[model samples]
Target: MHALPDIVGYLAAIIGTICWIPQTIKAWTTKETKDLSIWANILVLLTITLWFIYGILIGSIPLILGNLISICAVGAIVIAIFRFRSQ
Candidate 1:
């Protein structure tokens, strides 16, 4: 019943969250973010943060967990962009 949907939600969340891994890896290993847009990443992070807040309010584990991980992944990308850009 409800459990099935939540399971599906978690699966989707995992898939979505992992999508950032390659980019994060590339950004860190190459230290190259010239092609990555800071504004876009910032906006995405902001959106994910909002989703996380909403998830908290609604008590949705999937949204909360997914967005939390997303925030970290994207946050890392933002940091990478800045760290590499200044150099």
Candidate 2:
């Protein structure tokens, strides 16, 4: 019933979250932040955080877990951007 749909949702979340890792790693390794907009990433983080909270409220493991993992990647990039950004 709900199992198949839930599995699909989780799979989608996993794919979406995985997409951010390469960018995060690239940014971290290259120490390049000029092209990356801090505000945009911050907004993304905010949205994800809100979604994570919503997932918590709704008791959706996929949403909670996906956002949790995504936030790590995003948070790393954000920190790297701040750390490596040119003055």
Candidate 3:
């Protein structure tokens, strides 16, 4: 069965999703994304969006949930990038 693979995917997803938290927290606390590139963020968002779509198409729970959470986490960072720009 594919259960093992799916479980692995979920574990991987959890790790990937957690990877963004530190950056997000730093951005939120410092209110700085001055060094971050908008293009890079956009590209990352686009890639994640595609993954989310793919997950939907395949009906993989791990892919779906992981990417959804990732979208929100990374999305927050992107929003913060725009929201906390230095004047």
Top TM-score hit? 2
Name the lDDT value of residue 86 in candidate 2.
70
Q: What is the C-alpha RMSD of each candidate to the true structure, in Å?
A: 2.5, 2.2, 2.6
Q: TM-score for every candidate vs. truth?
A: 0.83, 0.84, 0.81
On lDDT, the leading prediction is 1
Whole-model Cα lDDT per candidate?
A: 0.92, 0.90, 0.84
Model 3: residue 20 alpha-carbon error in angstroms: 0.6
Candidate 1: clashing residue pairs, number: 0
| Least accurate 10 contiguous residues by lDDT in model 2 | 10-19
Tens digit of lDDT per residue, candidate 1, span 1-87? 699999998788789978888899899999999899999999999999999999999999978988998999899999999999976
Q: What digit string (tens of lDDT, one per residue) describes model 3 on residues 1-87?
A: 899999998688779867877888898888989997878877887888899999999897777787888788789889998998763
- How do the residues 6-84 of candidate 2 rate in per-residue lDDT, one tens digit apiece? 9998788779887789989999888888899999999989999999999999999978988999999999989989999
- What is the alpha-carbon RMSD of candidate 3 to the true structure? 2.6
For candidate 3, give the lDDT of residue 84. Answer: 85
